[model samples]
Target: MTDTPDTLLDGTHTVLTPEYVEFRFTLAGIYSRFLAWLLDTLIVMVGTGAILSGLSMAMMVFPGFASALGFVIYFLVDWGYGIALETAWSGRTVGKRVMGLRVIQRSGVRIGFYHAALRNLARPVDRLPFLYLVGGVAALLSGSYQRLGDMLAGTIVVRERRLKAPSAIGAAAGEGLLADPLFVSRVKRLSAEARELVLSAALRREELRMEARLRLFSALGTKLQELLAMEKPAHLSDEKWTLLVAAALIPAPGARTSTGARAVA
Candidate 1:
């Protein structure tokens, strides 16, 4: 990770992979996070209001039960909102997506259900003393602008940024691997989902533990080898081979564009 004066000041979290590839992301500040939270809160209130309206209508028959049920529903909606969306949407909620923010683990990987739930579960404490006063102060104090929830969950909210494909991308893949017509053809035949997995693995390889890194790249490389109907090059390791393929199959900016006919894992 290269730490320049500007990068430090602006909260750029850069992760360097084993292959010396750098993944850089800008940390979301408290202001953007607050805006995102406000939007989510607004949405949740509308949804809860709709549910409460039905409960209010039923309250005529069983006022006590319906009133109690309404309270439960509000709590569930408020607490479940972030957990549900962040898990299903891969660290993005309606508000976060709209604001171009995503919650990811400290290692720069996507957050899963556990992280989402833990973070959201801590929300009540973060909201102590009204208007998220404690959370706001915590974020201001944190270099990465993490609130209590984020700190507890080992996650940080980041703003999505687009990176351009570099010219002469074949260097990482060894001398002339990308120039081989047969290899390029096989890469182009990989499905969109396969392309993404390969690239993500290659780019984030260093973030994973050694065992995980080996297993993942081995499985990925083997699958690609079978799909492409080519023997693994004897000189390259599994991880290196996978990185070569990823370098060949570059993801377009902000979208997954593909020119493939067959599906590959």
Candidate 2:
């Protein structure tokens, strides 16, 4: 694998895979997660309450002991159900699916039962003293939306929904771009700050107006030039843009042509 530096978010250092960096969340992700949680909790509570009520009625014969048993059963069913759903569906509980949030491994892989177990198990600590106060603090401190349990489990919460595509990048295969050896290697080698800047800039591209975009490109170009310590090209072109990006990831010994000898900035 490539050895790129970690990305910093809100002062936290986070190592990122191309997929993770590329798919970074925005305000929409936060809203989606909240909605999903609300829906999922409502569904689970209603379902569980109905079952528990029936169990309580049946246990009327042994009031005290039966009530205790019912409580235990409820806890188990709720926790187990959530775990099963998240593990099976890659970090998505019913609520998350509806809201389009998902849990994933730090490496950007689908979360499995083991990882899910770790995060769920830590829920007690995260929720202690208040409604996820500890967990919230951890998430705020984390580069990714990782609560205490997720951090310990090496997992992250991410947006399931895709962002609006950047027109400049076109509709090339996302997988193919990430899979390129040169791209992967370069990404792996970035410093956390630089990586974060790159990721944030990429994600924000569509939001930028023309002037802002030009300004950003110029700033990025300057930063890249400093990073590579290369001479500035007499003129900038699309090929130059591609090469600069490539150069950020890999060291090109000399200029090479795709079909024609296009000049790269």
Candidate 3:
């Protein structure tokens, strides 16, 4: 099923999911990214400082003219440190980690060294025309918070929020529904195209026509209940099936009230 951000419920503040590409960076996300960046930067700075100090001391032991090498050593150290840190850790430098943000691929995947290098290398261009205007405009326009460098390199900067329990349940429940022995066997026996159609229908419920929706839901509900009765997973809670279905739809992290409203994280 090809899910899109438009399918998400309006005013529904759910946990971020792989299917939901539109990440809204909240206050907490900003703070977290900042924190992560700070931590990383401090580590890099200390390491660089120590290495440069040692190099300077070694250079002092050479002839007087050797002092001219200090500039070259300084430039090399700075360039190496910046590139290594940015590439190794994605777009996050020390500052970005402190802000709770990490650079990733647009598909919510980890970025590799090449993508990181491309974005970091373009940082100067992104800063042109005052106030990172180019980068800001790119981020605002992109589906994810991808700037010009990110677009060129196929990467994005996203807040690193922890997945909530409900989010996990949402992703797993789709598989759980088809896990029944009879259902599994039947699905497995179908042609690949038929199997895809059935699975797509189940996952992307909104795509079905209204009549189809009713028929599919009723039949699937009955079949699922019967299957559950045969060999229920011991760890499955006794919560109402309807509630679980609702929770699956409106997934939010952390515990909620009896009314199913989310509390503060």
Candidate 4:
């Protein structure tokens, strides 16, 4: 998947997958990225300090060992913080969450540990010559606002869209069905992981081979039907049925959690 240069003027990065499933993202601006970085740095420092403070008594016993242990603690906190959180939280660190930002692969999917590590490992180079100057120049030149780390990692920081109700889910009348309080209530009870699966499958259905797609959706539709104790309409395909569930699970505005970026995670 790659972005077309024609769509860059508005700062939108569109990925057209091999099977033509498309995704769009608004690239994070430098100011917002910087702020996110600042917040994350402070948090890292605080966390590192707290851990070190607990070892104060150990330091008195062995000054040399304490210095070495301090370095290790700093290293783990500095490196492990982003890697662990990004992998677990679907590309969001605490600072990124506060700033409404997320890191995603160029393929428009949630970042894995490899992606997180690459980006975090490159941060030193991005900070080269002081204060993220290298990274800033790279972002300015890249047009999509990607830093050196992002370029190396094949990932981009993006502004998350506000959660909104789906009007339709693949020709199923989601809006109309959502009007039924019982239907909405049942769907709202779907676990976050299940809802994420439903949406991710719907969004990427075009990318799967036909047999795989059919089998996958059929199983999901059957399981979901059983769980929700609801019957699919006689005419709706399994894929369409799954899409309907996906649409129903999207949270309205002001909701705390999200269905994720194109149901990424």
Q: Pick the lDDT winner.
A: 4
Whole-model alpha-carbon lDDT for candidate 4: 0.76
Model 4, residue 83: what's the lDDT? 90
| Overall lDDT per candidate, in order of appearance | 0.75, 0.57, 0.49, 0.76
Q: What's the CA error at residue 46 for candidate 1, in Å?
A: 0.8
* Candidate 3 wrongly placed segments (more than 4 Å): 1-43, 61-94, 127-145, 167-265
Tell me the tens digit of each residue's lDDT in model 4 across 1-265.
Answer: 3443523542777776443444467787788888888999999989989998998998888988987898788868978999999989888999998988899987777788999999988887998899999999999999678898899999988877553334446356433666778877898888755775677677666656777677788888898899789987788778777877776665555668944434422
Q: Candidate 1 — what's its lDDT?
A: 0.75
Off by over 4 Å in 4: 1-10, 19-21, 62-72, 167-234, 237-242, 247-265
Tens-digit lDDT track for model 2 on 1-265?
A: 2221221222222334332323233212334555775687677778778887887666787777876876677666667877899987657888876665677666545667898888887877987777667877777666565778888889767654343324433322232544556555655565644653554455455545666556666666677556644444556542244334543433233547332111100
Put down candidate 1 lDDT per residue, 48-153, tens digits, no spaces. Answer: 9898887676777787697678778877998899899999876889999888789888777777899999899998899999999999999889878888999999
* C-alpha TM-scores of all predictions: 0.66, 0.51, 0.42, 0.66
lDDT of 3 by residue, 133-198 (tens): 787677656555456887888765554444333443365556564445664454334443333223
Candidate closer to the true structure by lDDT (higher is better), 3 or 4:
4
Q: Which model, 1 or 4, shows the larger lDDT? A: 4
Q: Which candidate, 2 or 3, has the higher TM-score?
A: 2
TM-score of 4: 0.66
| Model 3 whole-model lDDT (C-alpha atoms) | 0.49
